[model samples]
Structures are given as C-alpha cells and as structure tokens.
Target: MAQDSARQAPAAPAAPARALLASFLPALAVGIGSSVLYLLMSGLAERLQEVLWGPLPDALGIGPYSAVWILVMLTATGVLVGLVVWKAPGHAGPDPATLGLTAVPLPVGTLPGLAIAAMLMLAGGPSLGPENPIIGVNVALAFWLGHRLAPRAPGPLWPLLAEAGTIGALFGTPVAAALVVSEALAGRPMRGALWDNLFAPLTAGAAGAMTTSLIAHPTFDLGLPPLGHPGWADLLAAVVIACAGALLGLTAVYAFPHVHRAFSRLGHPMLALPLGGLVLGGLGVLGGHLTLFKGLSEVKELAHDPGGWTAGQFAGMAVVKLAALLVAASCGFRGGRIFPSVFIGAALGLAAHALVPGVPETLGIAAGVLGMLLAITRQGWVSLFTAAVLVASPTIIALLCVASLPAWLLVTGRPQMQLKEDGTAIR
Candidate 1:
C-alpha cells in the first residue's frame, strides 16, 4: 500500500513545469502580436506623417515652413482624438503618472478599438506612450482567445496574465514588463496569483527577446563601462548625475499630471486640441522641426550625430520640446512620450556633455534617461534597465546602474502623482 501510494504520488515538480509553460506560451504570443502590431502601427504612423507633411517641405525649400508641419500635426492629432472619443470610447490607455505599474485587463472587444485609436493617436503625434496600448491590445486579445479556448480558466486574471506575458516578451525583458504590470496592479493583492503572473511574462519575454534577437539586435545606448570595473571618478560622477536625473524625472512626473488636468478642463477635445497644435507649432519653431512628433528619430540622431546640434541649440530645444510635448499630450494628441522622453534625456546629456567635457556624452545622456524614467515611473528596476539598455552595452548598463544610484534615491523619496478618476489627478 505504501509503495503504491508513493508510485501514485507526483514524482516531479509539476507546478514549476506548468508554471513555466503557462508563462512562456502567453508571453511568446504577446511578443509575436506586439512585434507585428508595433511594426504595423509604427509604419502606419510614419507613413501618415509623410503624407501629411510631404508637400510643405518642398514648398518652403531651404528654410522649410516647419511651422506648418507643427500645425498640421496638431490638427491631425486633434481630429484623431475627436475620432477616438466619438468612435472608441475608453480607448485612452492608462495615464502614465497615475498608472505606474498598473494593468486593467480590458475586454477583448476593446482591444481592436484601443489598437486602432492608439494607432491613430500615435500617428497623429500625441504626447502619450506606446507601452500602454501595446499591453492593452495584447491583454484584450489574450483574454478573448483564452476565454474561447479554456472556458473553465480563471477569472479576468488569466487574460491579464497573458497580456502581461506578451508585454514581457515584447519588451525583450520580462522583469521590466512585470514591474510595469505590478505598478499597474498597485494596491491590489497578488497572493495566489504571483506564480501565474510570473509564468506568462517570463515566457513572453523569452519569446519576444528571441524574436527581437532574430529580427533586430536591440541595443540601448546607456553610456557606461562594464560591471566590476567602473572607475572611482566615474562612480562619483554617476552618483552626481543620478541626483540630477532624479530631480528632472520627479518634476516631469508631477507636472505632467497637472498638464493633463489643465487640458482636461478645456472640455471638448476638438476645440482644445487645435489650440494644443498651435502651442506645439510655436514650440516647433522654437525647438526646431526635429522636436515635433514622437521624437524617436531625434533620439537616434542625437545618439549617432551629436554634432547635429550645438550645446546652446540642444538646451533651447529641450525646453521647447518639453513644452510642446506637454501641450500636445494635454490637448488630446495621440502618440507616446517614451521616445520623446528619451530625446529629452539625450538633449540633457548633450547639454551636460558640453559642461562636463571629459565624460562620454552618451553617459550623461543615459543618466538623463535614468533620471527621467525614475521620475516618470516609480519603477526603479525599469528605470535602471531603460537607462542601461539605450546604450546597448551591458558594461555601460552596469556602470550606469551604479552611477545613477544617488539620483534614484533622491527621486524615489519625492512625492508622486496618482489618478483619482477619469481625467482626474491627485497628488
């Protein structure tokens, strides 16, 4: 009887295996879907910009009428917001400051709406971020499919897990996505559901990372040397740099909510959004044409060609860009701030590089990203990873991690903004 009982008993760690598979499969799916959707939406957004702005440049020739571009972007964005509010209610993704690390598992039906609207917003050049839409659509789809496939699966949580997993995979890092998810789910209990969350994101991260590796060797240029070898001076400088970064980040996080609220008070997106475009247009004139839109192209340019703009130019651009982005976002423009944030960081780095001659400009830029991320997201780990990844050097990441500690600490201690209700912010 004892032998029979022993034989019948589970011999292996079924939970672990199951857990692994559970997380992996959903994450992979999320990665695939995210990758495909990201490419599609990004392409669409890019093409839209070309179509919208193609003619104006030729008309201006040498001294392009950049003002028109900004106006057009604002106009387009306003229209997109109008469409979203009218056609796809609740398509606005999470509010970043208020929604750090939180995930509301949206219905599957909502995914299509969210995706389309999100694409429109992004294409229109809003001051939002892409991560929310990407995660939202992924989760929405996962829930729909999961419900259909496993009618007996757990509540809304399962779909959420799958979405989170997909995010993990799409991000090429499970932990960052997990951090984002955890932040999104803040104030909620994770007891008995921890394993489930872990499984999905891990699997998704692996698949996404693998896919990313195959398609594009993603590297984040956070200028730092390899781990275990950061010079003492570098360490000291990093600490100082981190402190500066944290302050900026905190400011950004706190201020952005207020900015959003200001725009929210305008009542209708149609009227308010056009005004935002005008503001953005003015900013474009001040910040230069590159500061318009998502700012991804700008970040790349800053990283590769620092000479493109001088120190004075960079500083001016940063200030202008920040205002433009704030106005654009508040006015109901669609798109993400991730790239713009990075651009802001890069601009800061460039400014810092001019001041601190010896240090690699990349490092300063990276530190800026770290600070901004920390301020924007209370997620220290994600901030660290994001700061490190942009440099695409693991050594730099390690070094930057150590270097940016002081700033993280300072920023972490400051007050943060929280969302109270629809378009409401509570400090």
Candidate 2:
C-alpha cells in the first residue's frame, strides 16, 4: 500500500508539470507576438520621425533644428493627432490622464487610431512614453488571438500575458514586469500561490524581453562613476535630495488636475490640441530641444557631462520638463507619464548635485530618481529598481532605501498624478 501511494503521488505531480508546460507554450507565443507588435509600432514611428525631421526639413530648405521648424512640426502633429481622435474609429479609446498603466482591453478596432496617435506623439516630440497605448494594443490583440486560436485557454491569462509581455519589451527586462505585477497583485485573494499565478506571466515576460533585446537593445544605464562605499554624508545627502524631489513632483501633482481641466474646457480637440501644441512649442523655445520627447535619451544627454551645466541651467531644464509633462498629459496626448517623470527626477537629481557640489553625482541621481518616481507612480519597488538600475551602484542602495522612507511619507496621503472622473485625486 505504501509503494502504491508513492507511485500515485509522483503521477499526480507529473500531471501538474505537464499542465504547466502546456500553459507555458501558449504564454511564450503570446509574449513573442506582443513584442513583435510593439517593435513594429515603434519602428513605424521612428521611420516617420526620420522623414519628418530629416528629409522633409531638407526638402523645405529649412534647418531641422530651427525654432520655426520645431513650431511647425509640433503644431502639425497636434492637428493630425487631434483629427484622428475626433474622427478616427473608436475615438482613440479614453483620455490617458484618466487611465492607469493597465486597463480593460480595448476593442481591436480601436487599436488603429491609438497606434496612429501614439506614433504621431512619439515622432512629434510629446513628453510622453508609448507604454499605455502599446499595452492597450498588445492586450486587445492578445485577447482576440487567444479566443480565436485557443478557445479552451484560460480567460484571465491573455490580459496578464499581454501586460507582462509589453512591460518586458518596454523596459528591456522581465524582472521589471515581475516586480510590477507582484506589487500590483499583492493582498488579492487567490486560489494558489503567487508564483503559481506568476508562472505564465514570467514566461511571457522573458520571451518579450528577449525579443526586444534582439531588436532594439534598449537601456537606461547612465555610465556614471561607480559608487564604492556608503558614507554617513551620502545617506544624509540622499535624504535631502529625495525630499526635494518629492516636493517638486508634488507641485506637479497638485497642478495636474487644474491643467487638465483648463485644456478640457476648450471643449473640442480642434481648439484644445493645437493650442496645447502652440503652448508646448513656446515652452520648447524656452527649454530648447533638451526638454522634448519622452526624456529617456534627453536625460542621458543632461547627465553625460554634468560639469558643463550650471545649477541654474539644471533648474531651468527641470522646470521646463515638468511644465511640458503637465501640458502633454492634460492636452490629450496619447502616451504615458512614467518616462517624463523619470526625466524630471534625473533633472532634479543633477540640479541638486550641481547646487551642493558635496553630494556624489551617482548618489544624488539615484536618490532623486527614487523620490520622484515614488511620488509620481507611488510604486516603491518599481522606484527602487529604476533608481538602482540606472546607476548600477550597490553602495548607494542602502542610502536609496533609507531615503525612500521619508519620501514615501511626504507623498503618502497626498494627491497622486493621475486624474479621475469625479474631480478628486487618486491617493
């Protein structure tokens, strides 16, 4: 009887392993598919930008970097995006300010408008990321494909796989998706262990990350001096910088709804978007090209030679970038806020380092990123990972962890950067 029971247990475990492997195959395919779609969309935008900023400027006999060209391109981008939102199929879904990183899947038909708007925003230099719209497209397509191809597949699996895949592709890593999804799923009632639920998503994330790496090789490393050891002064400086960053982000958060409401009051895309673009252009003139786009490359440019910039210049860039983010988010631009917030954090960090001259550059940058990300996203784990990953410094990890406590306290119970329909803030 004991021998028979042992044999039966082994057989039962084999069944689960088989099931897991079966689920994993589909998840992997979904992840790869999602990554491919994301790459295609991003590639299309890059091609559009090359034409708009490269050959078109030459054809027009105007300098591509001139103020006039910048203004014309941005305004035209706004008009094109506005017309799409007003007249395209599905009306480009919902306002991004009211949506989070992940929402219910949009209809497949809505993907075309969203894709066009997102592409225009990317090429036209909006202070936004492709995270939201890309995820929407991935999710809708994944869900539709799953239903059509595998009717017996689990219903909830498609959305989870799509989200994980897109996040992995976006950040160029599976770990980011794991950390984000884990934080999001914490405390929810579940029938199984977290890792059990996570198994399929993780598979998808890995596939997505690998696919993106093979194609784009996206990275956030700043190539700063390595932080060797943590000192008392480093901790203190981190705290101060983090606190300051939190305050800066809070200012934006407080102003978010007002800006959103103001633009929304224009009552139509035709009036609102071009005006927003004009305002953005004027701000661009003030900020120069450094404050444009989603800010990933721009932040690197700012940090490449920190000694070249004055404290005042860093402050000005930070302020301008913040203003641009507010305008883009409020004015119906189709993109995400996280990348812009990350840029703002990097600018604030560099500004702090410039002003004080005592804080190490890497430490200041890491702390500033941590605090600003926490304030903006309210995701502590994601903030920590982003800050630490950018600098790739272990010595400052302890400092960043300590700084996050007070920064969290400041941002906690305050209005978040997101907007809700009820005119109240998300806390």
Candidate 3:
C-alpha cells in the first residue's frame, strides 16, 4: 500500500548521482589541463628570457636584457595574433569581461587563440598576466569535455560553475572564486537544483587545488607585515585608500576599451601587430627595462624591497607600465589585465607609501590591486580576492571587507554584456 501510494503520488524523482559527476567532470579535465599548461607556459616565458636575453649581460655592459624584451615579445605576439586573426574562427578570442571566473562554454577553437596569445604576450613582454589564459584554456577544455561526456551541460550553464570552481581551486580559495561566479550570475534567478549548484563548485574547486598542487607545489609568501589591531585611524585610512582605488579603476575602465577599439580598427592584423611592436619598442626604450615585460619582477621588487628603487624610478616605471599595458592590450596583444593591473597598483601604492609614511605596505598594495581590478574587469569578487590574497595575512582579512566597499559600489550596475540561455550572446 505504501509503495502503491508512493508510486501514485506525483513525487519528484531524485537526481542521478552521475549527472552531478558529469556536470563537474569538464572542470576536472580543464583543471588538470590548465595546470599543465601553466607549468609549461611559465617555463617557456622564463626560458625565452634566459635564452634570448642571457647573452646581453656581457655584451651590453648592463644588467640583463634591458628593454629589447618588449621588441622580442611584440614580434612574437604579432606573429601569433596574425595567425589567430587569419586562421581562428573567433577572430577576437576569449572575452574575460564576459566570462569572469565563471565557466562559460566556449568552442575548443577559442582555446588556441587564448593559449597562444597568452604565451606570446607573456614571452613578448606585454604588460599582461597568465590568469586569463589559464581561465580561457581550462574553460574551453571543460566545455569540450562536457560536450563529449554530458551533452546537456552547455545548455544548463554547468560550464560556468565548473570554471568558478576550477578558479577557486586553482587559487586555493573556493569561497572567493564562488563569490566571483555568483557576482557574474548576480541578476539571474536560480534555475538548477540546490545540490547541483553545491556539488559543481565543490568538484571544480577540488580539481583546481589538486591540479595546482600536482603541477607546482604551493608556497605562497607575500612578506606581509603583521596585522596590528585596527584603530579608528586605520579604518578611516582604509576608506580613503578604497576610494582612491575607485578613482584609479574608473580611469582604467574608461581607457582600456577605447584603446583596444582604436588598435583593432587599424589595418590588417599582421601589419597592425608589427606596428604595435614598433610602438611597444619605442615605449620600452623610453620606459626603462622594468617596464618591458609583464610586471612580475617589478611587483616582487617593489612589494618586498622598496629600497631597491628610487622614488623617481618608481614613478617613472609606474607610468611606463600603465602605458605599456594600454598599448599592448590595445595593439592586439593577447593576455589578461589582472596581473599588469595588480603590479601597476602595487607600484602606485608603493609610490603613495613613500609620500605618506603611515600607510602600511600590505594595505596599500591590497587597495591598489582591488582598485585596478574594479576598473579593468568590473569583477567585484575578483578585485576583492586578489587584493586580500596579495597580502596573505589574517590581519588583512578585516581590511578585505573594508576594501571591497568601493569595488562593490563601483561594480554594482548590470553587466555591459549579457548572455541568453541558449549560449547566444545578448548584447
């Protein structure tokens, strides 16, 4: 009788356990693939420097390769962009503004564009970062896997969840990446089962963490200052710093798209990239060696050892980096703004610190990263997470909440690009 009643009643069937696994499987593949890709790309970027620039140490009577890296990177990037523009289906490639850390199912074809572009840009010395490529490659791989394993995923937006999870896992911060995914999906009403949502993030995050560990043992040290008890002054300063970051971000948002558009409109991809290379070369000549490539060394030096550079040098490098970022991104170079922006912010913050002695280095660095992220991607959670993680200190945790205020305020509006349910873009 109980069985008959249970059968008769209109009960919702329990979801298949396999469905959950299938939904998250692509993310696992992407996480694994991306970890390998990151390792290779990181090595390639480093080796390209050692091989190409290594000889210059003795011949030039100077330190390292000097500013020639920009030329090298620009030429490589030009070739890569030319190939992508001519051969690739999506001429433009992965759009970070549209995807965030969320897994949006993109064609496998887009992956090559993103991968090559990132590698070249990094190798070529563009003021860009690897995170975007990491995201792009993984997201594409996941989508491809999803299509093969569970054909229904693209339709259900599982790709986006997987991406968020993978990113969270990659960064060793599931909650933070989840927050970014949620921010991207902010306006949308929840459609899937609660379990599906929960499991997807968990799997993706776990895969990312495992993959990262497998590739590169995680040993993150930011040389953070002790998080002292915050007095009213510190709180007040945080507010001021956050607001300053907002201003800086606003400037970047307004400038970046216009730069990209202007460069895209210039002649053929081949010619444009080379010309862009020339422009980058000229800028490098003017900006000093530190401004040539991705701002990693500069960021490391500035953050940990301020005395390594003079105030004039810091100010000059900041301008050069900012300009290099704009030019490289605008001129059809492939890479993400996240790293360059963070480095720029760090430099800017350090410069500010020199002027104002009271501001802690960690706090200033955090504020700069958040500010730049807000300006470039309009990703609130990303901006907040990046800033907090840069310090990697528990005391800075409270300030993360505080610093997020400006970013939250700035990025509160509806996204400029929206997508339809069928994976067709909606403006």
Candidate 4:
C-alpha cells in the first residue's frame, strides 16, 4: 500500500542540512527510550495478569477464569481504573473516545496514571489493546525528555520518532512504523527526498523493532494451514469476505458515538466505567474467555482451535467481541481497538471457513482481517500488513491487495470508530 513514487513526492525544497543532521541523535534516543517504556508497561501488565489469574485464584480455591472470577476481576479493574481517571492528574489524559492512535502527547505528569489505567484494562479482560495509550505515553515522555536533551533539534522530530519506534515495537517490525509515518506525511508539504525525510524515523523504528525481537520474540503468525496458490474463486471470496468484515466493523464504527454519548450522560467515570464493566461482564459470560483481554492471545487461541467451536459459536464470538470493543472504547477505558478488531476478523474468517469448506482458510482470514482493519483504522498499509502477517503467506498478498480495494471502497468517507471534538465520529 505504499503510494506510487510520484504521489509521495511533494513540490517543496529539502530540509536544512544542519537541522536534519541534528535530529538523528535524538531520534535514535527517542526510539530506544520509547520502546523500553512500551516493554515496561506491557511487561507489568502481563505480570499483573499472571498474579490475577494464577496464585490469587489458586489461593481462593476458585477455578481459574471461572465465570465469577471474570466478573469480579473485570469489575474491580473498572473500579480501580475509574478512580484513576476520576481523581488522577489530568484525568488519565482525556477520554479515549475523543482521540485516535495518533494524538497530541499527554503532559508528563499525566502519563503515569494513564499507564496504570491502560495496564488495568489490559490485564482485566477488556476487549482492547495497548497501542493507543502506550503510544501516547511514549510520545509524551519522548517529547518531554527529548526536547531538553536535544534542544536544537526540530521540535516535531522526537514525538514522531517515538511514535514510529513504539509502533515498530508493537508490531515487531519497522515496516509498519515506516508505513504509518509515510501515511502521516503523505499530504503535508515535504522536505527533501522521501528517504531523506524517512531516514531518522526509519532508523528509530528499526532499533525499536530489533529491541522487541531480541527481548520478546514477538510475532503475528497464526499457524493456519497454508494455501499454495490462489484462483479466481479465491479472489472473489477475498473480496466478499473483506466487504463482509468491513460491514461487521461498520456496526461498531456506526454505533460508537451513540454509545459514547450514552456513557457521557452518566456524568463521571466512577459511574460510567463500573457500569460499563458490568455490561462487559455479561458479554464475557456470553462470549466466554476467548472474547476477553487485548485479544492477541485470544485470537491465537481461536486460530489454533477453529474446529473446536461451531460456526454459530465463531459468529457469536465475532459479534460479541465487536460489542465489547465498542463498550470498552466508549466507556472510559484506556486501550485501542485494533487488537480486538483483529480477534473479530479472525473469528469471522473462521466462521466463513466453517460455513463453507470450499473457501481457502488463508483467504478467508486475510480478507477478514483486511476488511475489519480497514474499517476500524481506515489505514490501508497497516491493515494490509497486519492481515498478511497473521497468515504469514506471501502467496496471499495478491489476493489481499485486491480484496482491500473493495473493502476500502466500503469504508471510505464513513465515520471512523473514533470521535471528533464535538463528539461526532469522524476520521
């Protein structure tokens, strides 16, 4: 989904040589610093999850992930997160409903509480992801410390580097970071050649990516049976499933504001978040544990045992997870929609295969992820990257490329899953 070279270039002069060179050192520092922060935040969440789901439950003599435990932990998490957002400095950095993944950095003092809220949601089984808040924290820290350390560097350089680095760490690759940065740069008047502009950010991204790979060995491969080649039918199925997934995601995109407004009417996170958690508890009971959490592991579980659930069950999980994502985002949770959207796509793809054994599983999955991501994020390259990465089959790329066109057509110009300052959903 890289734009053609002609389109990427802008009719503008190159950046001043001195400023560009000054940016590199700080860019490298920002990249590494941001990724380390990402790891610390995510690691803390994982450890907390272990304690919450492991020894505490074992000590209490309750079955792990029992219905009661799910409800209790999630409700407690909501109450705790509510207290932070209610009373903490800067109210945990604004309602997530009003921001996209790319947002102005929060103040430095606000980041600690925001990180805590995000960790709670991650460990507490809300259908959300760490991407947004992690990026926000990283951006804030980078901007604050980076400016002081490299005062002569361009002001915009540090946060952009941190954003690229954090995204690279999140996806375990630099290409995602490159694509996202490129997308952001596409319309603005540019300086220098494309690569000149990209050099520092890409360097930071590579560093961040390598750091995560060496430390966590992160990956997206779902271990699905591979498809050797695709046919006309596969192409058609890809288009159909991509569109279907877009529609599925559209349900949430369309519902976001109404839901946000509903919770906003409740007048406080103390009231709204706990009640949202209760509603999410009901969803957990219906969708089971597979529909909970940030959804990376849950999606892997679904992919591993697609045969374990019936088609109806898969469909139900997809719908319920979508609802869970909507609720979590609309009701004061500090998390992102992408991972849960990934889960919904995987579940919908599995449901497609279950309904029609004729369709290739890989095709169903790539198209599903493509459609769902396109609808949710409204970004083409990352959506394509995510879908193709999960299947880990280069042969599926041609089909995904074609499928994304129709899916993109369906999602273009619609209200995004994110809300505007006036609270209407818009991209």
Per-model tally of clashing residue pairs? 34, 0, 3, 1
Winner of 1 and 2 under lDDT:
2
RMSD of 3: 4.7
| lDDT (10s digit) by residue, model 2, range 305-354 | 98888888888888898899889888998998888888888888888889
Candidate 3 vs candidate 4, lDDT winner:
4
lDDT per residue, candidate 1, 309-354, as tens digits?
A: 6778877776677676566555655444555667776777777777
**lDDT (tens digit, per residue) of candidate 4 on 86-136:** 988988997898776676877898988899999999988888999999989
Superposed on all Cα atoms, the candidates' RMSDs to the truth, in angstroms, are 4.6, 3.3, 4.7, 4.8
Predicted model with the maximum TM-score? 4
Candidate 3: tens digits of C-alpha lDDT, residues 1-427: 9999999997664665776766565655555555566667767877766654566444656545455554554566677766776577776464333343444556776766666666666766667666666666666665666677678655445456456645654465566556665665566676565545556655566666676676666533467686587666666666666666566655555565566556657767787677777777777778766676777666776777865666566666666777777776666666667667777777766766666768777777777777666766667677777777778767776776876776567645623222233323223
Q: Please give the TM-score that candidate 3 achieves against the real structure.
A: 0.82
- Positional deviation of residue 132's Cα in model 2 after best superposition, in angstroms: 0.6
Name the runs in model 3 displaced over 4 angstroms: 1-27, 55-63, 68-76, 87-110, 152-158, 169-172, 192-196, 218-220, 310-312, 410-427
Q: All models: lDDT?
A: 0.62, 0.86, 0.64, 0.88
Superposed Cα deviation of residue 236, candidate 2 (Å): 0.9
Cα-based TM-score, every candidate: 0.82, 0.94, 0.82, 0.95
Q: In model 4, which residue pairs have backbone atoms overlapping below 3 Å?
A: 14-192
Model 1 scores a C-alpha lDDT of 0.62
